[model samples]
Target: MKAAIIGGGVIGGGWAARFLLNGWDVAVFDPDPEAERKIGEVIANARRSLPALYDTALPAEGNLSFHSEMADAVQNANWIQESIPERLDLKHRILGDLSELAPETAVIGSSTSGFKPSELNEKGARAIVAHPFNPVYLLPLIELVGDAGACENAAPVLRSIGMFPLMVRKEIDAHIADRFLEAVWREALWLVKDGIATTEEIDEAIRMGFGIRWAQMGLFETYRIAGGEAGMKHFMAQFGPALKWPWTKLMDVPEFTDELVDLIAGQSDAQSGHMSIRELERLRDDNLVGMMRALKKTGSGAGGVIQRHEADLPKPEAPDLPITGDRKIPVSWTDYNGHMNETHYLEAGSLATDRFMELIGADANYIASGKSYFTIETHVRYLSELHAGNRLTIRTQVLKGEGKKLHLFHFLYGPDDTLAATVETLLLHVDLTTRASSLPDQAVAEKLGAYHQAHAALEQPEGAGRSVGQKA
Candidate 1:
């Protein structure tokens, strides 16, 4: 797939990085001479962040080119994105030309935050609003508004690049999320103007309080829980009267004077001047990853989207050895020493055991039938240290497989071909309902037996039969 980016500003660059990283050839055009350098910086940050969100590596990145002419950029593109300055005239002018130059089948998306589709299409330009959040490569939400058929056609393409396409039922100014954001922003600005709170304090108020809740439960759901056992109606009944109070200046706009601008900018600098923008971006990405992973376990909200996407990603087709877990060590998995934590070796082994079970017909369906493997013993030997971002591969060797017991050994190697760890584990099949040892199903037993026979000629790893003791 190929995507053309017509403006290489921050948001446009982000769109480029997203498509390029997801294996789409990208052609970018911008009048700014420094657009290539600026976009390259964004791509650098994206490379560090996006792949860190997944356990497996993303597809090999697609080709990227800086085009000198708009016509050349859109010549053979599958998708064309317009992220020029948010001026309707500028959009119409460029889009009018784009419609004439680009293929009619190509998706034309506008990253316009304020303009409605009606205004954008007023000049007979068939463009859709595909407004995405900042750091577009990381955040999944993309507000899609336009023709039904066009939006529907773009949905799968957006999903292919790990984005959530929120097709708006109706065309509205500023779309959905930004309307809410503008309200909060207006309130925050007033608070600063009235000297009720500083910029940092206002940020703290959100990040330390409702921001976390909003991430998973969103607004109505969070308040519904706050309503206690009675539900949303009760909560609305209790707090709806407060809406009339003069508590907030939501309807008021603060004067945008030079003094106000300087004051707000000064306060923001004081709040986060210690870190570079790159440093802050990394911090934000790490926090998002941590929170999203926590949500993944519970299968809720944004985390659920990530979990489902990860499932859809095709497993890396390495040669079919029992090598189940192959991935880069995430930054979150490291300790202060910048090395992978001690416990993750066993975690990787556990993942391999699950994969081995699936390969032998002891999958989710089989386990649902009241039979599953339970680890009875495990021994891990640290051969060497592994640092964060190190690519690791696990190779499994089946030692024994019988009626109810299976023994296996896993060897973990780092990028440099050094053996980093070894895990030896023993498992027993059990019936969940009866809480007793169970004979393996015939199909599973046959598969396990074949694997055991295949690995029987290999010598046992030195660490496997060793007991915990000091040599005399």
Candidate 2:
């Protein structure tokens, strides 16, 4: 798949990175002489963070190209995204040209935060509002509006690239999310203008409070929980009258006076000017990845989107032995030493053991049937240091697989195929209902015997059957 990015500013560069990282050839058209460098930096940030969100590896990155001519960029593109300035005339001109130049089947998307699809298509441009949040590579929501057919076509494509496409039933200005954001923004501006809060304090008010709630559960759902036993109705009845109260200045616009600008900018500078823009971006991305990964455990909000996308990602093919675990080391796995903590080595080995169990039909279903393997012992030999962001691969070899016993050896290879670690594990087949030693099922035992027989022919691993302090 190929994507054409019409502008290479921050948002445009984000779009390009989102596509390129997802294995789509991306062609960017921007007259800015510095566009390439800027986009490259954005992609660099993306490379460091996007893959960290997944336990499985993303596809190999696709090719990226820059074009001086918009016509060249849009040629043969599967998707064309317009991200120029929010000027209607400029959008009409570019989008109209895109309609003529792009493939008829190509989905033309506008990253306009405020403009409606109808307004964008007013000048005979068949464009849809595929508005995405900032740092598009990480944030999953894309508010899609316009032609129903176009949106329906875009949703799967967006999902294929790990995005959540929300189709707006009505073409409202600013779509859905931004409208609510605009209201909050207006109230914030009033507070700042009235000297009720500083920029930092106002930001703290959001980030320390509702921001976290909203990340996992949106406004309505959060409110529904707030409703208590009676649900949304109880909460609404209690606080509904407050809606008409003069508590907020959302309807009143704060004048964009120079003094107000200085006040906000100065306060913001004082608050966070120490960090460079790139530094701030990396910080934000790290926080987002960590939070989203936490959410993945519960399949909440963005985490659920990631979990679904990960299920579709192709698993790594095994060589002679099964490649049980393949993944990037996220920052959370590192410790004060700036390398992977010792605890995670066992965690990785446990995951590999789980996968191996599945291979032998001792999987979730088998466990639910009151039979499973319980790890009784493990010995991990740390060969070398593994750091965060390193790609780790674990290959498993069955040392012994007989009734009531399963012994396995795992080879942990780092990015350079270096012998980073080795894990020797021993398990016992057990009856979950009785909580006692038991023989494996006939089918599972057959599969395990086959693997054990095949692996028995191979030479024993160097660290096999060794105690913790045993010499090499």
Candidate 3:
């Protein structure tokens, strides 16, 4: 598929990166002379961060081109995303031009924070408000507003690019998330104006407090959990009355005087001015990757979306070798030495074992039937250091596969084709409920025996039989 981005600002570049990295050819039209440089920078950041969120490799990136004319950009586009500034007139003009050239089936999405669909559709254009948060390549939530059919048509396409599309039932000013964000912005401004907190203090309050909760559990669910056994009703009944208090200036406004602006800017500068914007962006991406990976482990919220998507990702093709894993080392797996931690070797081995189990017919369906392989013993030899961001693969050999016992040997090779680590594992087929070893089914046994026989002639690796002791 081909995507055309009508602007090349931060949000627009992000859209380009998201679609381009997902294997969609992208054409971006922006009048700015520096649009290409800026969009290239955003794509570099996206390349580093977005793919780190998953264990499997993303599809081969699509082609990217910059165009000066709107007609040239949207000529063969399947989706046209308009992320010009917030001005409605400019958006209407761009959409008018886009609608004229774009394919009839093309979905036109406007990244307007405050405008409703009706407001944007005034000139008989069928543009939809497909508002996405900043760093669009990473964040999954997108608020979509438009005709039901248009929104519905865009939903799967958005999801196909690893986005969560929230189609608004009714259009309102600022949509949903931005409305909540606007409320917080107003309150934070009031706090700064009232001398209650500095910019850094307010940021710390959010990051150290509810911000983490909001990532996995949104406002209502977090409050529901806080309500104990009674849930949301009890929590609302207890705290809803506090809404009448003057604790927040939700309805009030703060003057955007030069003095106020300088004060906030000065505080922000003092807080995080040391790092360059690129450095800060990398920091933010690293944190997001870590947090998202944790959420993936638990299968909740945005992390759950990533986990499900990763499961559907196609496994990398292997040659004649019995390949178990083909993925990059996530930054979260690195230790203080700037290389992969010792524990992660075992983690990688465990994942390889999972793949091996699937190869032998002990898949999800089999495991769900109360039978699965349980690793009883594992020994890992770390031959060399493997750093974060390194693409690696695990090669496996079945040493024994009979009765209820399975012995496997795995070799982990780093980016340079050097063996970074080796793992030897012993597993037992067991009934999960009984926790006792059990005979493998005939089909599973046959597959395992085939692998064992195929690998029988291979010589043992150097560290295969070593024990933890000094030679006398």
Instruction: Name the best candidate (by TM-score).
Output: 2
Residue-wise lDDT of candidate 3 within 36-136, one digit each (tens)? 99999999888878888887777788999999788999987899999999998987887888778889999999999999999898997889999999889
Model 1 stretches with alpha carbons more than 4 Å out: 317-320, 468-472
* Sort by lDDT, top down from the best: 2, 3, 1
Query: How many clashes in candidate 3?
Result: 0
Q: How do all the candidates rank in terms of TM-score, highest first?
A: 2, 3, 1
lDDT of 1 by residue, 181-208 (tens): 9999999988898898999999999999
Tens-digit per-residue lDDT, 1-472, candidate 2: 9999999999999999999989999999999999999999999999888988987788888999999999999999999999999999999999999999999999999999999988998999999999999999999999999999999999999999999999899999899999999999999989889999999999999999999999999999999999999999999999999999889887789899999999989999999999999999999999999999999989999999999998898777464798888888887889999999999999889989998998899998999999999999999999899987898899999999998999999999997899999999999999999999999999999999999998988999998999978777
TM-score list, all predictions: 0.94, 0.96, 0.95
Cα lDDT of candidate 3 equals: 0.90
State the lDDT at 355 in candidate 2.
83
Off by over 4 Å in 2: 368-370
Error of 1 at 126 (Å): 1.5
In candidate 1, which residue pairs clash?
A: none
Model 2, residue 61: what's the lDDT?
86
In model 3, the runs with Cα more than 4 Å from the true position are 468-472
Displacement of the residue 232 alpha carbon in candidate 1, Å: 1.1
| Residue 292, model 2, lDDT | 98
Question: What's the residue-level lDDT of 1 in candidate 2?
Answer: 94
TM-score of 2: 0.96
TM-score of 1: 0.94
